[model samples]
Target: MTWSSMLLLAVTVERVGELWFARRNTKALLSKGGREIGKEHYSLIVALHTLWLSSLWVVAWNVRVHPIWLGVFVCLQALRFWTLATLGKRWTTRIIVVPGETLVAAGPYRFIRHPNYLVVIGEIAVFPLCLGQPLHALVFSIANALVLTVRIKTENAALSGSRHV
Candidate 1:
């Protein structure tokens, strides 16, 4: 397999690991009275992510992968790892509010309120562009941006109402 393919596989593994960790944390939080809001929006998040992954796979299989672009793709994947590591157990794919939880202000949270989303934004372009599919990048980037805009607004509002924020 090419480096790009390997990098993509590694990312998929890391994502799975992160989700496993997040699930454990989420269960603990729920046991402590954490509540999930915006169920509908969360569902939309799943759909969008599915589309993003599908597009990435399609482009990866159908287009020619370039070395420089592959290198950039790896760098972006590292950034994604950074975002996940920074968030630790607090990182989740869903909009869940743990009751009485304080806002996190350490790590990447110190520099930007939503570094995870920034990673997402970068990946939407990096992956497709690596495979010489700028059109895929452009199309999905726009869709991802729209979804993230709504997600940020809702999440920020939730944070504002919380004791944290």
Candidate 2:
């Protein structure tokens, strides 16, 4: 299979694993009376990521894949996985702030306040560029940036008022 196709397959598998783990985490949090905030933002995140992935597929469909770019994309994907694993039960597509929960300072959080967002920013550009679609990358990156700005601000506000983990 082509590198792009292989990347897609790997992403699909990883997302499935993430979903399974997230579900378990969600259930545990909910059982503990944890409340979720900014649910609409979660939906927006899903939509934007869907658009980004669709654009990658569209660009890859017509263009010749570059090996160097594909390699970069793979690395970005690995970063994404690492971020997710680091976050563990704390990771969610939504901005859920469990009441009284402490901030996570370990793993990727040790270096960046929002490592997952960093990975997402990289993926938005990396995948499209791998397919030689700078236009799509530009558009989607801008859109994702705007959405992330709102998300980060809200999430920080939510966490700031809470105690440290």
lDDT of 2 at 47: 86
Superposed model 2: Cα runs more than 4 Å off: none
User: Can you write out model 2's per-residue Cα lDDT over 1-165, one digit (the tens) per residue?
Assistant: 775677666666776776787788887777777777767678788888887776566557555777887788778777777888877777776666677778888777788888888888987887778778888889989999988988888888777777755
Model 2 TM-score, 2 decimals: 0.86
Model 1, span 1-165: residue lDDT tens: 765566567666766777788788778777778876666677777777778776576557544668787788677767677877866776777777877788877777788888888878888887778777888889888988888888898888778866634
As a whole number from 0 to 100, the lDDT of residue 24 in candidate 2 is: 82
RMSD of 1: 2.3
Q: Give each model's whole-structure lDDT.
A: 0.75, 0.77
Backbone clashes in model 1, listed as residue pairs: none
